[model samples]
Target: MQQNNEIPQFDLAEQIMAEQRKNASVRRKGPAKRVGAPNQKRKVEPLGHTIKPQPALPEQEQIIAEIVARDIKKLCKGNARSPRTSGF
Candidate 1:
């Protein structure tokens, strides 16, 4: 029967991995948990803006907004998309 070098190789590999992990750094991000309901809560506001209710508008504004959105879609047919529509 013949012995093998595999055991020492395995030990060395484990030691290298442990050392690397000890020296490595990682960046963490975002909230640890959901803060609030997506639709009901506003995202954290930028500087100078506070979380506030969207204003109440006359019924006419809704229709005008829709019409403008459609015109924007038409005008944007070939342009680079804004972040709002591309989602990143």
Candidate 2:
């Protein structure tokens, strides 16, 4: 006896898919709807006019010490020294 390798279900599926592709090609699609205002231009503000003036930063050493002290305090939890005495 010889075994048949052909699949009948796969052949049917292929035929159905071909028909769907033909139908889709014949269908008409409308133009896409506009999302936002296309004609309006964005208002530009002068540089630094909208931003509030920031205070001058402390020395680099002071900044580094403050960050280190904060991290140490976090790690030590309740054992860390008070902020006033720590001089952070």
Candidate 3:
């Protein structure tokens, strides 16, 4: 029995894939650029005249407002129970 010392040869498909990988690595060394459409600077236009924002309400007033809103919501709800009219 005789053993060969030569390196094993890759098949045609394996050779193509190896070549592709080698080419890909070579390409990765350089900075990549976009394929199409040159970048344009967009002009930002102001939408109408900006109105001055009103000052925020005081903390105490905000709390009172929230309470009033909640009570109003409860009264507006269709499922809210009405006071019993029958005398017990």
Instruction: List runs of model 1 lying over 4 Å from the truth.
Output: 1-57, 78-88
Best by TM-score: 3
In the range 7-42, model 3's lDDT, one tens digit per residue, is 988699988999999999877654455365668878
TM-score for each model: 0.24, 0.27, 0.29
Question: Model 2 over residues 1-88: C-alpha lDDT tens digits?
Answer: 9999987556878899999998997774545643555877889966865777776567866898999999887867744554444444
Off by over 4 Å in 3: 1-10, 30-49, 53-88
TM-score of model 2 (CA atoms): 0.27
Q: After superposition, how far is residue 12 of candidate 3 from its true place, in Å?
A: 3.0
Checking candidate 1 for backbone clashes, the offending pairs are none
**Residue 48, candidate 2: C-alpha displacement in angstroms:** 12
How many clashing residue pairs are found in candidate 2?
0
Quick one: ranking by TM-score, best first? 3, 2, 1
Model 1, position 27, has a per-residue lDDT of 37
Model 1: weakest 10-residue lDDT segment is: 25-34
Candidate 3 residue 4 C-alpha distance from true site, Å: 12
Worst 10 residues of 3 by lDDT: 78-87
TM-score of 1: 0.24
Model 3 lDDT on a 0 to 1 scale: 0.77
